[model samples]
Target: MNRNPHGEIEEIEEEYNYVDAPAWTVDKVAAPQDQRSLFFTQSFPLIAVCWLILLVIMGLRIHFTSESNAKLTAENQQLEILMHLNSTLLAAHENLGRYCNNLTVQFDLLTQNCTVLESKIKDLTAVNQQLTADVQNLTTRSLQLETQRNNLTKQIQNMETNWNKLNVSRAQWSIDAYCPRENNARLCKACQEGWRLNQSTCYVVHDAVSTSGHKTWEEAREVCRRESSDFVIVHNQEEQYALNYYSWFSTLTTGYWIGLRAEGWRWKWIDGSDLTVSHWTPQLPPAADGQCVMSVQNVGWRSVSCAEKKRWICKKKALYV
Candidate 1:
């Protein structure tokens, strides 16, 4: 050993530096044990410090790895939750869309039904109006029918009363005209002398053989009254035709007086009854109060002045067996 200028001890190295040097010689040239022990003691501190720094670096790496693994696990959990929520939201959205479609279809159907119902309502309204009008017309017709029935019933009653009165008058006239005054037992004859029997009455058509045979209407009626008879009364078409056959016409002015006369514009019988029928010539007379009806042969009756001299016919009810 030698001391350098820095006052540190330096050891001289043996020169056996061959790769294949003998092991015995190398050992023989080695430093003493005390010297090696002193060298190891100084180097031990440096080795311990290096091992401590390595251990600290390994611990820091383990801590950073664990922290990164935890963060990745948390991120995976968050991703899974977000995916589930997105799936649920998609399903909800699909369901909502289908529901809206269904609602739209139903709304359209309801609108169509409303339109059809409105048309039906309009048709029903028209039918109701027609029915109302028909009901009103039926009511009016029923009222008219009821009034007509009432009027017919009244006319039937009047006709029945008049028929009864006529029957009574006929019986009285028969007794007066056919029974003789001198016979107390009231022996009746069919007709008096010079009187012709028709149906139920006796008639006498006095012929005007010349103008002297004709008499005024009042004079002819007076003569008939003296014989218990009156001027002829035509009651029907048959009676009127019989009177026409019985009458004589010598000229246009020659006619026989009858029991009809004009009271106003209407003709009436001498018994104060209205004329129910008439047979007049084509040239009718002007309506006047004093005009009397005269019968012509093969022609109809004519209206003439009551004072005119014309032949007359008398009539009385015939006696029955």
Candidate 2:
């Protein structure tokens, strides 16, 4: 069957015509009709459904991408802030290290100062100890000196008492004896019994005649020696005056032997004293060898024979009061 341009169906006649033609001549035939099925019309609804699902999936993918981008931007800002904070912390750490170093230096200096102070303290303590020891020694020495002073004071007091007593006894003796005023008061004496007090000496004038016939000069000298005395040696005018006074009072007209004698033409006393002063008579008696000196009443010294009998004066140390 064939369809025309006009919406009508037509049938073809089945006629065979034989033609006389050449050997290559053949009959012309029409192509067979297409019978393929329509695939677009049958799958239209399924394609629409698949397209809707793909649209939904694409929208969901866009939303997820936007969310991930926002999260990444926030994370970047946080990282920048952390970096700045880290830089500030590093700077603070460096400053802290410098301060720590300064503190360490100060501590070392303080330690050195403390050591010096301790050394000074030790020296001061030693000096103080030495001073204390010196003070103690001084105190001990002072005490010893004080004790010695007390003992000396006591001894001096006792000596003063004894001296006072002695002075009193001396004054009483002087009053009783009526010591001569012509002699130096300091040198006067109070003689023993039967002795006459003179200047620092005691004299014994022997008036009694000797039992061995009137004594000679040698015999008088012997008698004075037995009494622990010696013949009087008159050296001055005062002594001569005293003798004269005694002779006048005793009424002695004869001479008395003295200790003077001539030796090698020079006069000397028996006690080795030089005769510097003399009371010789204006007309000295003719001196003879072995002649001694004598003092006569109303006359000065005269040389006499050693064998002549005469009175004698003996002199000795004065007795202590």
Strongest candidate by TM-score: 1
Per-residue lDDT over 70-164 for candidate 1, one digit per residue giving the tens place of the 0 to 100 score: 87888888889889989999999999999999999999999999999999999999999999999999999999989999999999999899989
Predicted candidate 2 versus true structure: per-residue lDDT over 1-321, tens digit per residue? 122433222112211222333435344222111111233454456677677777777888777777877777777777778877888888888888898888889889999999998998898899889889989988998898899899889988988897898678766665555455455464444675678877777888887654344478889999999877899877777777766655532223357788888777667789888687777776655445688887776777777788778777888877675
The alpha-carbon lDDT assigned to residue 221 of candidate 1 equals: 97
Per model, state how many residue pairs clash: 0, 0
Judging by lDDT against the true structure, name the best candidate: 1
* Whole-model alpha-carbon lDDT for candidate 2: 0.70
RMSD after Cα superposition, model 2? 22.5
- Model 2: weakest 10-residue lDDT segment is 28-37
Cα error, candidate 1, residue 28 (Å): 99
Cα-based lDDT for every prediction:
0.80, 0.70
The TM-score obtained by model 1 is: 0.41
